[model samples]
Target: MPAVPGRLRAVCLAAAVAAVLTGCSSSDDGSGTGSGTGSGEPSVAETPRMTLTAGTELPLDAYERSEDDVYALAKAQNVLTEQCMKRYGLAYDAPDPSPPAHIRPNARIFGLVDAGEAARYGYGSVARTGPAPTKPKSAVLGETAKSVLFGPKTKKSGKALAEMPMSQTAAEKKKSGLVVNGSPVPVGGCLRESYLKLYAPTSSSVDIMYVFNLKGEAESRALSDSRVKKATKAWSACMKKAGYVTAAPASAARDLGFSGEAATGPGAVTAAKADVACKAEVNYAGIRFAVQSAYEKRSADRNAETLGLLREQAQDRLRLASQLTS
Candidate 1:
């Protein structure tokens, strides 16, 4: 039976995001050396011995060529293996034909091979014997709500929502305020139509992207309701009871016939925006809530980050919807 090393097992279970970010290859076999023995008949009293070197390059077929060739390959492979083990703090072992079940193929290992070759030939970070593996593209998503909301859906196409021109003048026309609580918040001009375009980055995995879009729509609707005045008032009372300050309604001049309140906390760099948008035709109303909070985490770090970023983006969508409905 092939021995399954513990270190290799750990790499297979690491988070995909961490794997991508750390630039570590999961497919690397912890055992770096190969061995072979001479086939010719030997004296009964003689013991066969082999020589090895660490940090050298060897071809994959070197073992099949000759005793000298096998020795050279074994030495080189052992050297490369030793260097990697030292770098990662893993145990060294001879190569095994059957590796662990979880071990996957990685192109990055080829790079290490090339580096070993280089080290052998006086070339820094170049391999002297076999071909090195290829480096995969880092999965980074684009900066559109739509892109992030839909991952692989957008990854293959490389399409994102159109960017709209930022306009302070347009915001002013609607009686919107700038620098809410000194946070320098930009009032989006096309808040209503823009909701249709916001996408999450593409590099994000599928599950995370779906949650972002789903939550974004939910929060957007909640903020745009005309009945949000009562909800905001209730929420404000709750906040005050919880030791937060109460927010005030918008002034008549700045009010676009929409009912809502804007409040700032004592130490808040920005104020929260809450409003109600009425849709009599559909008999539906929306209550918008907009606020920023420090990113929070849950049990899993990556999941927590995804949720935190999604929540922030959802709040932005709500803010935009408030402007449109107002």
Candidate 2:
């Protein structure tokens, strides 16, 4: 129920790259202000929550998306875009989709909570301790191709959009759109065609992140639950005893000042180990994860219909993707 970093997201922007990108990287919870009746779990009678069995740690039975679902859709969309551009004598090469995190979704969200990471660099962006990833080389496009696939930049503004008030005739508007090769941009624009081919018109409106955001909300709520509060207090005391005064995992990481090359040094490693030790002693993560997971199970049960629709759309898009490639 910890919003998996790559899984939770808002849906409105999904129209542009939901299938491809949500499948790529992630975060968000849509709920506004809580009732704020804080400091404990609600007194209402609760459903008996299940504990983490090997099979039940994640409530995946409600729905799931696999790496294949994302990769296939991305590759297929690229293929379509490439072919469309070929027709207009433009070279189009789509980059390979970014790799998914190797850890479970929850692990990616919490980041350095991974034992290896904690032992190594304490808490910080990996780049704090090590070199950043190399940028992948991308295909180069010509001016015509860029203008055709993306709209032509306005000559006056040097931007994709024109000065709204300055526009007048329909012909000028059309001219502003594209001048691909020697013809108008192919129907629907090359990128739009590729997207339509990979996803349903209706899916353009669906929020890919709804389920994930709900998971985030569950996490937020769990943070305030009485059980979590108790565990957090115990963890805080342990850290304080070690001369590290911090209330929560995030705060501990921050107060440690995990920036620059110093993050990988002796002091940082020592504090990180203590942080991990405290978490284990208090069972803070275990309790929090369990509480949030229960919340997610409840939410998934309640929102099964909408979740099903989103999953089906992803499946359908991937199916089309496969066919397109085949």
Candidate 3:
């Protein structure tokens, strides 16, 4: 069958539902609390952990090490001990009168160690689990937003797909039955969607993924139940209150997963799978809104780079969708 188009009007209606329904963040410790296993006792659910092999770089080691050892290491590395202390909420022991000079703390360094520890021992950082701020839908809507949303469907050929402009491909995809709010959107108009793949080395790994969607000049709507909408709205509202601007033209966000050997080799593979079939459409919003929402909601729990990459992809896709639609 010829695909349905995603109409702005329909999208607006859907946005209304979504605005009231999607997005949220978790705590800084990465733990989800709940009842124990049939014990009727309150339980502090532990967050999933990650492991790191030897020769890996770790930044937070300074914070995790003995204060004296860290002090010595910092001095040797030409890092200002006091500044490093402050960054990780430790007491400064150096007596330089004024704060030490040129002690640049690297988030990457800290993150490497933090991630390694989490992987090896299954414990995440408290500060890393805090909720991120919220963002607005307008932040993502750009000059080409309309075109990408209504653009053409994208083919699967590596070269053809790569050669096809994002906006044009989005337009084509809209015509191929991609629906938002139960209406047909014209190819080359205003929205976009795509799929991603993720992998988990062990069944114990959290393997969680998120799918975000944003809309403009319209409220967010939810296709699912109220719980999902409520969670998303809470997350979105938090981001808006935090001062982020949406910068993408169009986009879609989703979490991907894999298991066993597939998770161990390579990272993860991208695949075309139905959203409904996977039961993965927990939350959806515009690109910018979704980015902010995810950051504000899960920023502390996940790798900052991972979140940043996801946001970038969403924004890029949005731009492509707009181009195709226009």
RMSD of each: 32.9, 11.7, 26.6
| TM, every model | 0.15, 0.68, 0.15
Best by TM-score: 2
lDDT of candidate 2 over 186-259, digit per residue (tens) = 33456755665555344333455566677677677767765556667777787888889887776776777865
- Candidate 2: segments with Cα more than 4 A from true spot: 1-57, 60-64, 99-101, 108-116, 124-134, 153-176, 179-189, 203-205
Model 3 residue 67 lDDT? 28
List residue ranges in candidate 1 displaced over 4 A: 1-207, 235-244, 248-326
Model 3: residue 179 alpha-carbon error in angstroms: 71
Give a tens-digit lDDT track for model 1, residues 1-326. Answer: 00010111111111121111112233321222111011111001111110112322211111112333223333443444333333323334433222122212221221111222322321122232433334434334233322222211224655322232233233233322322223322223122212222222122312324443433443343344222334345544443443445442223113222222221221221111111111111111111111000000111122446455545654553344344334
**Native-to-model Cα distance after best TM-score fit, residue 106 in candidate 2, in Å:** 2.2
Cα RMSD of predicted structure 3: 26.6
Clashes (N, CA, C under 3 Å) per candidate: 38, 2, 93
